[model samples]
Target: MALPKAHRLKSRHDFQAVFREGIRRHSSHFTLRALKPAVATEPSLDTASPTANYASTKIGISISTKVSKRAVVRNLIKRRITAAFYQLLPKLAPGWRLVVIVKPTAAESKCGSQQFLQELEQLLAQAEVLNGHS
Candidate 1:
């Protein structure tokens, strides 16, 4: 299943903001960049609800041609990444904008979903973006 719209970073501006302002965390397979969304900088105006105070995490996945010259491989990587994120969403901290960039090493690894999930979890932990982590 696809993630909800609120859980995705869809626009170029959003992606650029994350790239420009986010903190960097790296794993063997991917580099995770995350920025805690600022209160004043929120792009969405649907903030009157009490639940809106607790912003949902938004994620973007970028797989460049350098990682896989074939679009099919790149798309597969994207799907896997999204699936991994979906599994981890509830456990993840809220209000952060995240970008996961697949590295060449990741493409070469040809890891299965479980291994990809493990790598992603490790990256999230190191980035301190996961709940119950210091």
Candidate 2:
């Protein structure tokens, strides 16, 4: 079964966790940033844990209405982000919650599934989220 909307953790938790833990994230900023620390300092770390069993990655979306109040564009961005997760998370470890902050730039990127996958590939490589690929 997949995780429901209310159940996933958005990337802001990373910012909060990083702030609270006194750790800095090794990040990849695409108008947005992916900040990561070596170890988590809060209970949420349990969510980002990497184990052997299959697990659904928790995702967060922070697309501001200022970017586009239209539901269609917002939904499209959400769908794109979700699609990115499904394609990339398997190549990563299990049980990690990722926060994806969308900038207005994402509203213009015409990336396909493979492009999105490649973006994720680069992201994981930078965040050290990949398995052996890391």
Candidate 3:
């Protein structure tokens, strides 16, 4: 299963914003970009709760053709990365925008899902975006 809509970053603008404003955390196979949500100066009347709109973390995955010429191979990498994110979702802090970009070296590596999970967790921790990482 894929990440829920609320947790997935689909807009090109959102991706660009994160790329422009987010901090970068690197690993051998992935480069993580994380942007903390902007502080709301005033509570909006449109929502009953002040924090309702920014209560979930949003993520995007980018795998370039340079990583793999074949769609199947690139898709497999994406799926593995997505699965790793799914497992770590609950531990991630809310109100953050994140993008996971796969490195070209990843395509030639023989790493598995577990390795992806470890690298992702390490990156998030380094970025201080994981819960309890303050």
Candidate 4:
């Protein structure tokens, strides 16, 4: 199943803002970057409620060619990461922009699901981006 629209970070500007202003947390397999959402000067026409948009969280995942030359491998990594995020969704705090970048070592080593979940959880915790004690 696909992630909700509110959870997927789709725009270049949003990605840029997160990358530029976000706090970084590193793990063995990946790096997590996150920034609290900023107030928008203008409301988007696509969404009926600006408050809802502002209150939701968004995420972006990146698996570069440097990590894996094969598209299949990169996609597999993305799927793993997305699946982990899906499981962690409820625990994540809202109104934050988050990005996860897969590292070269992770692609080369072919890390397992357990490792992925652990690394992601640890990174998010260190970043202080998760809600409660996740």
Q: Is candidate 1 or candidate 3 better by TM-score?
A: 3
Q: Give the TM-score of each candidate.
A: 0.88, 0.60, 0.91, 0.86
Better of 1 and 4 by TM-score: 1
Q: Rank the candidates by TM-score, best first.
A: 3, 1, 4, 2
Candidate 1 vs 2: which has more TM-score:
1
| Model 1 misplaced stretches (Cα beyond 4 Å) | 39-52
Which 10 successive residues of model 1 have the least lDDT summed?
A: 44-53
* Model 1 CA lDDT for position 7: 95
Look at candidate 1 and give me any clashing residue pairs. none
lDDT by residue for model 3 (13-99), tens? 999999999999999999999999777778666666767645799999999999999999999999999899999999999999999
Please identify which of the two predictions, 2 or 3, would achieve the higher TM-score against the true structure.
Answer: 3
Kindly provide the TM-score of model 1 when superposed on the true structure, using C-alpha atoms. 0.88
Backbone clash numbers for all candidates listed: 0, 4, 0, 0
> What do the candidate models score in CA lDDT, each in turn?
0.87, 0.55, 0.92, 0.85
lDDT of 2 by residue, 1-134 (tens): 23366436645555465334432233222322333323444545465545423455455666787667787987777776667666665576654545556666556666555665566567667666567765
Sort order, lDDT high to low:
3, 1, 4, 2
What's model 1's lDDT at 16? 95
Q: State which candidate has the highest lDDT.
A: 3
